[model samples]
Target: MKLENRRIWITGAASGIGEAMARQLSGVASLLIISDLNAERLLALKPELEKGITTVDALPFDLSNRTEVEKAADKVLATYGGVDLLINNGGISQRGLFYETTEEVDRRIMEINFFSYVVLTKKMLPPMLAQGFGHIAATSSMTGKFGFPLRSSYAASKHAVQGYFETVGLELYDRGIRVTVASPGRIRTNISVNALSGEGTRYGQMDPGQAGGMPAEKCAARYLRAIRRDQWEVYIGYNEILMIWFKRYLPWLFRKLALRVGKV
Candidate 1:
């Protein structure tokens, strides 16, 4: 479970939390293969990451494309022999009310957030199973655990991630593959702008709530610790960390408070 000198593949490495993780893990990993839709950003990061770690490569492709993911998975296996860790972090977000959100918007969220993860995991599982050792880490959200208003589709997609991976973790536990799900509260990332709007369009704006959230590097460090320890789940945030407890023990109060805070 130690990250040092490990062979790792991280998606969504062009920016935000993924970018931070790539930077932090760069010094720790022996070979790092990063991917994202932003070719330019990925290229830009190469030099910086190389300064931290000698071996850093970036693969740019739309993860929503199953063909692209399959090809990428093949390349990773062929080149690396096998991946020690597969971080399924590439995903989009949801915005606006469910009723107001277009069907296309819902579909888009499901595609990037759920289907992409499923397909990528499916393609990688065989290699991991064959190797008999691998780590699978995903970036879920607090909303994944507790539903919120104006974000039904987003919440649902993340919930699906948790459900699918949690089951997969148990099924693969005896086989030596480890799965860790992260339910992070609001963090300083570009998720708002990347989120699909009500009309199935990009929001093209950042929310203040996200802007004021925890630093990306700090979150990345914590995630590294979780992976090193092979923790099953880790919740990240300030005061909002308590939401996990409330959601677990006081469902009625949690629902009421969540309703007052937003919608449920």
Candidate 2:
């Protein structure tokens, strides 16, 4: 579980939580493969992160494109033998009412947030199994544990992530593969600003809650800590975590409070 000299691949590494993770992990990892749709940003990020530490490499691709992901996986495996850690962090967010959101929007969210993770994992899993040890981690959300207004599709996608990782952990742990699903509360990241609206447009604005939420660096630290400790799952952030308790122990209060939690 120790990350030092580990070969790690993090998706969405150009910015936000993925960037934070790349920074936090760079000094410790032997090879850090950072992937994103933004080739320029990833290239820009490389030297800053490398700075005489990890072997930082950028693989720019659209995660929604399964063909690209599969090819990328082939190259990655061929290059690194196999990654010791695969962090499934490449995804988008949602911020619109269910009724207002189009079917295409929902599909887009699922494709980017859910299916992309599945596709990349499928590509890398066999190598992990063959190599005899590996870890798969994912970023879920507080909403993944419950639900939220204006984020139904986002919540649904993360819910699927939470469920899938749990099942993977249970099914693969004995096979030399580990799984950790991080159900983070709101952390200051570009997710809200880039979140897809009902009409499939970027929200293009940061929510007040997000601006005041836990810092992305802090979230990344906690995520790495969870992986190091080999935890099956973890929840990061502050007050938003209370929502989980409320939903679990006080469903009525949770339902009422959920109504007033405002747009995330």
Candidate 3:
């Protein structure tokens, strides 16, 4: 599980937690592949990240596009022979009521947040299984554990991530493939501002809670620690993480508090 000299590929590396992970992993990994939809940002980040890592490759592709994901995966396997770690962190958020959101918006969110993870993992699994050693990590949200207003679709997608990875982890644990499902609470990221609305337009506003959340660098540090320890599931955040406990042990209270919190 040690990161030193490990070959790693991380999606959503253009910003937020993924970017922080790239920066931190660059110093430890022997070969680092950073993927994102923002080609300009990924290209700009490559040199900086390369200064630490032995090799850094910037791969830009839209996660929602299945064809693009397959192509990227093929390129990685063809060139590098496969990676020791695959972090499926590319995803989009939602900020709309269930009744108000369109089916297309829900599908789009699921496509990026849920299906993209599966596609990448499926394409990468053959090599991992052949090598009998690999690590996969997916970024889920606090909403993945429970629910919240204005996040119906987002929560559903994250919940799916939780279920899928947990099952994958169980299935592959005996085969030397480790899976880490990271359920991070609100981190100081632009997820809210970039969240899709009911009409599929950008929400374009930052929530107060997100603005005051933990720093992305700190969150990324915690994530790496969990990975190093080979933890199956890790939750990273401040007090918001306690909500998971409340939901598990005190569902009634959790429901009450959830209602009181209202929309973000």
Which candidate has the highest TM-score of all? 3
**What is the total number of backbone clashes in candidate 2?**
0
lDDT of 2 by residue, 1-264 (tens): 889989999999999889999999878898999999999999999998895558998999988787888889889989987799999998898889899999999998988888888888888898889888999998888889998899889999999999998999999989989899998898998889999999999999998889999999999999999999999999999988999999999999999888777634
- The TM-score obtained by model 2 is 0.97
List of clashing residue pairs for candidate 2: none
Q: TM-score each candidate.
A: 0.95, 0.97, 0.98
The local distance difference test score of each candidate is 0.86, 0.91, 0.93
Any runs in candidate 3 off by more than 4 Å, and if so which? none
Candidate whose lDDT is highest: 3
Off by over 4 Å in 2: none
Candidate 1 residue-wise lDDT, 7-106, digit = tens: 8889999998899999998788988898999999999998888855548888888877878878888888788776788888988887788899988888
lDDT per residue (tens digit) for residues 127-228 in model 3: 889998999999998899998999999999999999999999999999999999999998999999989999999999998989999999999999999999
